[model samples]
Target: MKKIAILNGPNLDRLGKREPEIYGHTTLADLEASLRAEFAATTSLDFFQSNHEGALIDKIAALADAKFDGIVINGAALTHTSVALRDALAGAHLPTVEVHISNIYKREEFRHTSLTAPVSLAVISGLGLEGYFAAVRFLLKR
Candidate 1:
């Protein structure tokens, strides 16, 4: 089976509750279940979510060392702020796709820039949970 890691950073664990107007009512667990059910037959999935930058960076390193085929990451608040996370992703050199529940382009000015985008295979934003599915499907095909 092809291995893919889905990494979520900062405030994403509050998916259903944090900002329902923008993030929707679906919890992270619900999203995971949806992804697992959709791709379980053909892909081996590893899901990790953290509020800490170091933990997420550590996961990127571990995934790279383990030779994961691809990654789907929603860096959340870290997307614009963490050069360390961006560096980790770049260093990993894994085929990575960045995801966002809301369109970062439509949000606050700071959210518009993503340090991780330059190193990713693609970035899927504004599609809600579908963005996650899209990222996984794109990676699976790649």
Candidate 2:
């Protein structure tokens, strides 16, 4: 089975709690279920979430061996900062799709800038949970 890695960073574990109005009431586990079903016949995915920068980087580093065919990453708040994560992803050299629940451009000025998007094959934002599925489908195409 072709495998994909779904890496979420920073505060994603608090998805439903941190911003219910924006991120919706879907828990991380619930989202995983949705992603699993969405890609059931298409791809097998390993979903991981972390709040620490180093842990997130570790996940990226550990995947450097090409164990996964592609990646769907929601860098969360790290998208705007984290040069280390950017470097790790660049080193991985795998097709990557980045998603955000809320429209970062429309939110805080700080959220307007993303250090990671430029390196991603595609970026999906302002689409809520559906964006995740969009990313899954995108990976399945490749």
Candidate 3:
């Protein structure tokens, strides 16, 4: 099985609760369950979520050290501001996909920019929870 790490940052833990209007009703746990159920046969998924930038960066380093095949990350608000997180992802040298539940471009002007996108193999936006699945599929095929 291919080993993949799913890392969520910042307000993502508030998925189903924080902004039901935009992020939808899918909880973090629900997303994990759905991904696992869909990719169980071929993928070994490890999920991690953190509100702290350091913790998420640490997790990325750990995943790289452990030789994970790929990463699916939704850096939440960090996507716009965290240079350290972007560096961690680039430094990890693992195939990565950045996901956003809502269209960042459609939101605030600040959300339009992603510091992590250049390091990611792909960026999936406006797809809601399906972005995670698409990222995993792309990584798995690669």
Per-model C-alpha lDDT, please? 0.95, 0.88, 0.95
lDDT of 2 by residue, 30-105 (tens): 9999889877887888888989898878888777685788889999989998999898899888889999999988
Q: Itemize residue pairs with steric clashes in candidate 2.
A: none
Expressed as tens digits, the lDDT of each residue in 1-142 for candidate 1 is: 9999999999999999997999999999999999999999999999999999999999999999999999999999898999999999999999999999999999899999999999998999999999999999999998
TM-score of 1: 0.99
Q: What lDDT would candidate 3 get against the real structure? A: 0.95
- Which whole-number lDDT from 0 to 100 does residue 44 have in model 1? 96
Q: Which candidate do you rate higher for lDDT, 2 or 3?
A: 3
**lDDT of prediction 1:** 0.95
Q: What is the lDDT of residue 81 in candidate 3?
A: 98
**Tens-digit lDDT track for model 3 on 1-142?**
8999999999888989996999998899999999999999999999999999999999999999999999999999999999999999999999999999999989999999999999999999999999999999999999
Error of 1 at 130 (Å): 0.1
What TM-score, computed on C-alpha atoms, does each candidate reach?
0.99, 0.96, 0.98
Lowest lDDT 10-mer window, candidate 2? Answer: 59-68
- Worst lDDT run of 10 residues, candidate 1, spans 76-85
